[model samples]
Every structure is written in C-alpha cells, then in structure tokens.
Target: MSINPRTIRWGILATGRIAENFATDLALVEGSELVAVGSRRLDAANEFAERFGAARAHGSYEELAADPEVDVIYVATPHSRHLDDVMTCLEGGKHVLCEKPLAMNAADAETMIAEARSRGLFFAEAMWTRTNPNIRRMLQMIRDGVIGTPLQVRAELGYAAEAEKTRMWDPELGASALLDMGIYPLTFAFLLLGEPVSIVAAGVLSDQGIDVNAGATLTYANGAVANIAWNQVAWSDNRGTIAGDAGFVEMTSRFHEPTGFSVTRGDQTETYEEHVIGRGYSHEIIEVADCLREGLTQSALLPQDESLAIMKQLDEILRQLGVTPR
Candidate 1:
C-alpha cells in the first residue's frame, strides 16, 4: 500500500486503553498514520508502538512532542494532565488533539486554547462522539426542521463504579460521575441546544468528596430544557431522546457509540444505523485529516469554544455539589 505524502502523522502521547482504541482506528482511516507512541515507561511505549505499528516510540512525552516528524500529537492522558500535556505539544509546534473534558476545569481549558491560538496551531478536544456520522445526520435533521423546534432533550449515561477503588471515584485524578461519564450527556445536550441559561444540579458524593452519581437540569432562554443524568455507581439505559414541536429522535443503547436512532413524527418514523470502523474513532481521525488539509485551525464539528463551554458547565456542576479538586 502506498502512503500519501499528505497523510497526517499522528504521535500518540499515552498507552492507555483509549489511546490504543484510537490508534487502531487511525490505522483503518486512509491518509493518516500512527508514527509514534509515548509513555512514561520505555517498555510500555515500545510495546504499544509495536502493537500499533508506529515507527517511533519514546519513553518521555517531551521526546514525542519535540519530534519534528510528528505532524500532530494526540494527548490521551488523564483529564488532570490534559492541559500540561497539550501545552507541551503546542510549545513544540505540534498540532494537538486533546481528550475531553479538555482539562480539569474551564479555566485550564481557556489557558490551553489561548496557548494554541497564540502559536497558530490546530487544537481540538477529541470529543469522538460528536464526529459520528449518525450524530451528524441527526443534527442536520434538527437543523432542517425535520424535528421542528427542539423543545427538550433527555439523555443519560452511566456505569457501575466502586467509590473506593476506581479512577472514576478518585479525586486525585479529577474523577467524578460528572467529569467522566456526565460530559457525554452534557455535550450532547449542548450540541442540540447551545449553552443553557441556568443549571440546577444535585449529586451524591463519596467519602473522598467526588461525585458518584449526579443529575442536572439545564434551562435555555428559549424555553428549551434538558434533563441530563450520569452515575458512576450504577448502570443506566445509556440512551438519548430529543423532542421538538413536530417530533422526536431516539437513540438506542450506548448513546456515545455506534448504534441506531430513529426520527418520528405523526405516526411516521425513519431509522438510521451505522456500523462504524474500529469503535467509531476513525470518524474523528477523518475529521482531523480533512480539517488540517483544509488549513483549518479548529474543527467546525467540535469547536474549541463549545468544548470550553462544556467544561464550564461541568465545573459548575462540580461546584454546585461542592466537590473541590484534591
């Protein structure tokens, strides 16, 4: 197979599960190559690079960030480390795609965005769910008036986690039901309806002061509302629905992953399904390639401002619950 010269060279800056999933998807996406993998441990980086067929493996993130051959760096570290990792890459003149909740808080996200802008670099949060084809189609349907004026959106995402052990329950890692799983539903709501005018939230906190289960109601000025819920201590339906004056759209299990959804109105319904390649991560990789080729500094699909706004909402949710960072 011949590789295109225009291919975007991806340098993955972590060897965690999400990093592996994304690299596998990048392998399937044309015009993109995983050129490097970095980890705090040399052996881990080498092993991951070998598994992903990356040409270079570095023991330190700084090495990967400083590599001139790497056109872009994907910061797949934890939420607390995102700002530092992304800024390091940006300082090295490498375009960055940081994982979502772009940072631990909205303030940190603002700093990272400002740094990227100052360097004239491409920076985006890897909100892969926003890049799914079905999501794009659904958003278009809403915009086309197929769903009329969106009046309300109800979405939930959750997974069982023990408050004592997992990172989802750990404050040191910036873990909380809201920051980890909750961001999905929140971002989904924000996508359908822009920033809400007011937010009311309630949460159950663990002994460590991190939220284990959380629910929020967002009110928009146009009378639109969203009920978003997330829990780290129990499983949920993990589905979503958007209701408009005309009809509604319903997504099946795993609202964040590849699945089926239907739009219904007046006894009429249309279903759309997609079986994505490699856990749906390829779609985001394609978006990155397209944007970079077009000389875009940020993705129109997942704008930096929208990401920052979502982070701000998450920060507010945590604040409402009085969960401070460790």
Candidate 2:
C-alpha cells in the first residue's frame, strides 16, 4: 500500500461486501486512510473496522457521519438507502463518494447534487470504470480519431442470479439487472455517445417485480446508436465494443475491470494490455483524494450531468419496460 504524508481521512458508511472491497483497494492507494466505518449493527461495524485497520467503528450511520475526524464518507449502502445516507454524510459536513446509481431516480440525484453544491462539498458518483487506465486510453483513442466517425456501439453483461429473496432479486431493495449490472455497460456507452435523443428498451421481470434481464437501444441526435444489455438470468459474453466506419475497439469479456482489449482497422489489428493495481477501485479512490486536496467539488471524468443523464435514461428505459423505478 502506498502511503502519503498528506492523508485524507475516510469513513465508510456500510459494512457490506462492496465496502470490504473498497477498503482493501483504499489501503493500496496513497494519501488516504480508512479512519472509520459504520453499520446498522455494532458487531458488523467493529468487524469491518478490525478487518480494514480502521481506527473507529460506529454502530449507526448517524454516528459515523457525525464523526469529526472523517473528512469524507463513502456511501456503500443499498441503492434504496443511497439518498438518505448521502444526505446524512453531506449534512454532517463531510464530502461524499456515493456508489453508482447515486439515487433511486433523477429527482433524487438532483437533490443530492444540489445539497452538495449548496454546501460547497465534493460529491461524486463512484463509476470506477471511468477511472480505469485502459478505459481512459480507449476513450482517448476515440477522441483522437483512432476510430473514425463513431457510428454504432454494442455492450452486454449478464449472469444467472436466481435467489429470489436476495437484494439482487428483491424489488423492495431497488434490485434489478439494470441498476446492478447494466449501469456499467450503460455508463460505458454514455461515455462514447452523449445523451441520446431517443431510447427503446425491453426487459423481463421476476416475480418480485425486478428485472431479470433487460436490453436497450439508444439513438443519439447525431444518428449514432448503442445497443446495450444486462441480465441476471444467464451468462453471456459480457463484452463491450465501439464500432465506427474506419475502425473498431473491443474490450474483452468483463470489460469493466482492468482487462486487456484490442483495436482493429483496415486488416491491421493492435492489441493493448492492461496493468493495474488493486481491483481497479484505487484509481477512483485516488481521484477523490486528489479532488479533495485541490478543492474541486466534482470530477470531470464522472460529472454530475453525465450521471444525471444516465439516470434519466435508466428511468425512461424502465418506464418503457413497465418496471416501476423505486
């Protein structure tokens, strides 16, 4: 783990599996320290803190948010509770890096953004893929015209999750393929093409009213289109691609992480290798630390407008698919 003399004190607001992963990644980052963690149960909180070498553990999110030593809080709670948890952290005078799908809807996201703005605090959606090194290179290639005139895109991620009572299948917890797995592919597509003029979507819902699998087609004003899909019903290629008239870029299956990919054009192909540290969450962690140190409130990589736009697309797609967004 890289250590920085100028440290940013961090407080984790949940003790779930994602929290553990994030904590492990944070340990690998420089200029950050996991000072505190919170969970609904004191035992879980203590266990998380002991496992991650955190100095403080709070039984309730309120106590953790109120901790005067924590400069920032990472909200790793369920999607249904994201709005409240983020507000709690912001209200307690701490910056926040909330998990993806920062809120249940665009309206809630707007509220979170406005609250952060009014407080002059740093707030960002933790779309970690946006900070991946290879993703950055791929986007730069597209921006530098490696792919001529982007015309169409395709992204897919799927897995078979059959537990009916778990958070992945329970509508009460805002569970769905779209929010759980689709956001990555959707955000990937949004990075390539801005807001779409129209979106067509279809999906199959489980008995709990959550989407088991869903697909969407986004048509941009520039006539570019993206076909993206996500599911919890079956395993698929889990590949992502960007195709243009001149060339195409392909991310290997499970493109969200630090994985190798390739580019091809005119019978000549080039492959790029990925070398990253610590589950790839460190990039975003370091991004947050850098932003906080520089007094920036948001990241250009994962901007508020982009997050909101993606949320709108998600809401619209779910609406069209007859799924009530919680």
Candidate 3:
C-alpha cells in the first residue's frame, strides 16, 4: 500500500492459467501496470512475464514478495495454499487479492484477515463475480423489492473436470464440488440471503477423499431457503435463481461470470445483458485500485465478514458430507 497513486503496480504470484487471464484483463484496465510475475520455476515466470509485458520475472515466490516495485500481489494458488501465500505477501509489505475460498477453512481465513489487519495492509478474496455491473444491478433490484421477499434461492455449478493430480480431485489441496466449484452457487445464495441459520448437506466423495458432487439446503431465520448443488462428474445447467413471492430473477449459465439475468413476474418476464471487457476480471482490478486510492483495506462490494462467513459455511458443509470430519 506504500506505492504511489500514479499507477498501481501489479505483480502476479503464479504463472497458471488464471494468472494469465488476470494479466490479460488487467491490461484492459487503464490505470494498472502488470509489473512482475513469479513462480517456483524461473522459466515459467519468464514466459508469463514475456507474454504479459511484465517488467520483471522472479524465479521464486520469495523473490516476488520481496520486490520493491510491487505494490500488490494476487495469489492465484489453490485454496489450500491461500493462508501461507497471503501471509508471505502481507509480511513483505504488499497488499493481496487472493482468489476465492480465501483459505481451506474459517480459522485459516480469519488468520489471513488478522495478519493483513496487523500489517495495516489491504487484503481481499478475489470474488470477481460480485464486481460485475449486472450482478450489482441485480443486488440493487432485489433491495428495491423488484423480487419481493426472497422465498427461495437455488443455484448449481457442475462440470466434468479434467483429471489433474495436485490441482483437481485432491482432498489435501481442498478440491471438491463445494470448495472448488460449488462455491459459486453457494456464494450466489449467500449474497442474497446472508448466512444460513442451518444447513443440511450431502455429497458423493471421490477416491481421493474429496467430494465429487454435493447438495445443500441453506435455511435462513426469515423463513427463506436456498437449495444448492455442486458436481464434478457432469455438467448441469450451471444456472442460479432466486425466487420471491412477487417475482424471480435468474442468471444465465455460469452465473459467477459477467452475464445476463432475467426478472420474471407473474405475467411478465424481463431479461438483462451487459457487455463486459476482457472476461470481467477488469471490474475487480478497478475495485482494488480504487480502494487503494481511498486507503481502504477491504471493498464494500466484497467485504471481509462475508468472506469469513462463506468459509465457515464451506467448512460446515464439508463436515456434514464427511469430506472433512463430522
């Protein structure tokens, strides 16, 4: 956060596909610079930097964290590594935007948040989907009573994931229908209903001890309920919906991304769509820059408390399904 306001310098902490996509979208934003990239392997770092116009490529994450020019670091590693990776950046005096499911569980997530607070640094879970314009409008519309009282919320994200050793299908790495993919549907539900008063979750676990598919019912104290599903076996509709007494709104497939949504009443239905630049990561990038300029630690749009609540829910769901422990 000590970096000047002239141009926000960004350094990516991984050279994976998400890192590449982020760098590409970051370039689409006007006021940020893709200054550096780092990886365990030096060649991978160099290759990512060369492709993305980064000024420096560090062979090790330690090197990237120690870079004097990097004002912020985006942790794109798997969920299991979030705490360690984020702590590295915060201790190095750089702000962080760690990818979603900020850590494997609530305790680790709170630890990350606490560290950032202790260091007086900005830190956020990179839930980029919440930053989309269409989703923002949807939130406003719901608050305006366009959807009446939310009676039910249902969401699901499913796909046949590629077989990967360390990344996917590994319980130790926190791979599961809920943490890896189901989080989108769960997040969609959480944004609308806040935290659930109680949950009943069940799932099918993989041979590696991860849940391949799962379902949960989140009940709110207000008599609202959300039924959500997640899977890695096959692709579902990838849809999300929130239904109220007056009307209902449903986001199209891949609801987590920048996409259109429709609001339906008893006799009328309205659809919405907006054009997004470069796959929508630009929105969160801009949010980070703005927060930095204003000296804010966390974004109002994506708050720390909400992130912690989501993690706590995920941990509970895992326990219910026996993916972790009861």
Candidate 4:
C-alpha cells in the first residue's frame, strides 16, 4: 500500500476472539481502517472480514502480509506463534502490533524487536492496559505527587480457566497463569516502580509444567516492594493498589481494564471515573494510529524496551517456579 499517514490501513492476521475484539476497536479509531483479514481457513477469513467490514479476506497469513493495501498488520496469534508470525509480517514489509507477552521468552522478543528495528517498521506488543485512560491518569497523578513517593504495590488476577480450555494448560501453546494473567500485574508494577533490584517467586505447577498459581515479591532499589499474584485455578479479587508515603491509589477490581480508581490521603479519599472506549482496547488502536501518522516506530506509552524488560521478568519468574522459561 502507498502508506497514508492520516488513515493507516490495517490487516488482521488471525480470526480468533482477540482479533475480533481488536477489529471492533480498530473501527472506533478515527484514522484506522480494517482493510483485510487472514486465517488458515478461507471460510473463517471470509466470515471475519464480513463481520468486521474488511474489504479483503486472505486464506493464508502470507497473503495478508503481502496485501499491498495493508500498511500494517495486527498479529493476533497466540504467544507461541508470535515469533514466526511477526517475522512473517516484518519480512513482508508490514508494520505490526503483536499481542501482549510479545513472545514466549526474552530471546524471541529480542529477535522480533531487532527485526522490526532493522526494518524501520513500527511494532509494539499490544498491552492494551498501558493505553487505558484510567491507567494513564493514575500514572500522571503519581508523577504529580498525588500519591507522594510510592512504597508498595499489590495486584492480583486469576480465574478458573483450565478446566474448560485446553489451551490454558497446554505447554505447547505456552499456556500458563503467569504468561496469560500474571503479565498484567507485573506490567502494572513495572509502570509504577520500574525495574526491581531482585525478585522472589514461587508457584504451583500442573502436571504439564505450566503454572496453575504463582506469586512474586519484587524489591526495588528504594525499599519499594510489589507483591503480585496470578492464578488459573480459582477466582481472585483482581484489584490493585499502589501505596506511597503520602497516600495511596486503588484501582477497582479487574484492574487490568479498570473501570475507575480512588486516591486516599490520610483522612480524605477521592474517587475518579473515566469513560473507556469500547472495552478499553480502542485506546491502543488510537495510540498506534497516532504513532504511525507521526512516522514513529514505537509508542512512548509502551516502549519496546519496556516490553523486553517485562518479558525478561516473566522469564525469571518462570525459572523461579522451576519451569524452564518458555
């Protein structure tokens, strides 16, 4: 495609649920267009394109990547397939937004990032929370001293998913509570506290060697600590808190896609409610479009280096749990 800065043409490289949600939000992004969709099955691709109003449907991923009308491709495949799929897009000269947990491990993530940087193509792990308005608002407040000096972070996310989904327990698919659910809280802590000085982690692993439940305590250089947990065997409160010297900020349950937040200072508490665009996924879409228009290869909101750092943390956490880092 002759790239149009104002309206970036997008191709969806999968027809899964995440791809559907992303396509839904991509429609809401002002300067983005869903031009094509691809799937292993032509029927599935056609169905997705029809539902999403995409102009073309390709039976194979390569065809979608080679689509001259697509300026960028969204690789919505599972993390296990990310390296190959992302490389395919980059090789075909298409910018990419691969879904979160960018790759199964740091080495693969580094490879994907290096490929994109070498090609001068825009690329980002679609960690949609980083672009959420509520998250951004809270980060700004912390920076503005609303919470003073943050000293601790507590976050947890979990659900009983393995019983119903083979993918949730299958090692071949890189399935685990840590990669699927833990990444959010880990990224949350990283956003508030940066890299940690050291980490102590332990978890319960299934017979298949994937984590069923896990917890980690990260100690930072300035005496700050973040305790994060992830579980696939039960339900959790799913809330998060960042406590600082002067006060604290609490995100409502399901913090990853927070509906609102509250701030407290000694004797006072103030609550904030922000409107989220379609499932809060549209913000990342808007962010990617804006970056493309500005001719940038990365989003400042979720930089490539930060993605790599988080992946390394995940790798370490997995190793601590006695599972070979995927």
Q: How accurate is candidate 2 locally (lDDT)?
A: 0.89
List, residue by residue over 58-162, the lDDT tens digit for candidate 3: 998889999999988999988878888888889899999999889888999999999999888999999988898888888899999998999899888888887
Clashes of each: 0, 0, 0, 1
Which stretches of model 3 miss by more than 4 angstroms? Answer: 164-166
For all candidates in order, the CA lDDT equals 0.89, 0.89, 0.88, 0.93
Name the lDDT value of residue 34 in candidate 2. Answer: 96
Off by over 4 Å in 2: 1-5
Q: Per-residue lDDT for 1-326 in model 4, tens only?
A: 25686788999999998998999888888889999999999999999999999999999999999999999899999999999999999999999999988999999999999999999999999999999999999999999999899999999999989476877888999898999999999999999999999999998999988899999999999999999999999999999999999999999999999989999999999999888989888998888888888888999997999999999999999998999766
Q: Which stretches of candidate 4 lie over 4 Å from their true place?
A: none
- Tell me each candidate's RMSD, in Å, in order: 2.3, 2.4, 1.4, 1.0
- Residue pairs clashing, model 2: none
Alpha-carbon shift of residue 174 in model 3 (angstroms): 2.5
- Show the lowest summed lDDT stretch of 10 residues, model 2: 1-10
Which model is ahead, 3 or 4, in terms of TM-score?
A: 4
TM per candidate: 0.96, 0.97, 0.97, 0.98
- Arrange candidates, best TM-score first: 4, 3, 2, 1
Q: What's model 3's lDDT at 22?
A: 94
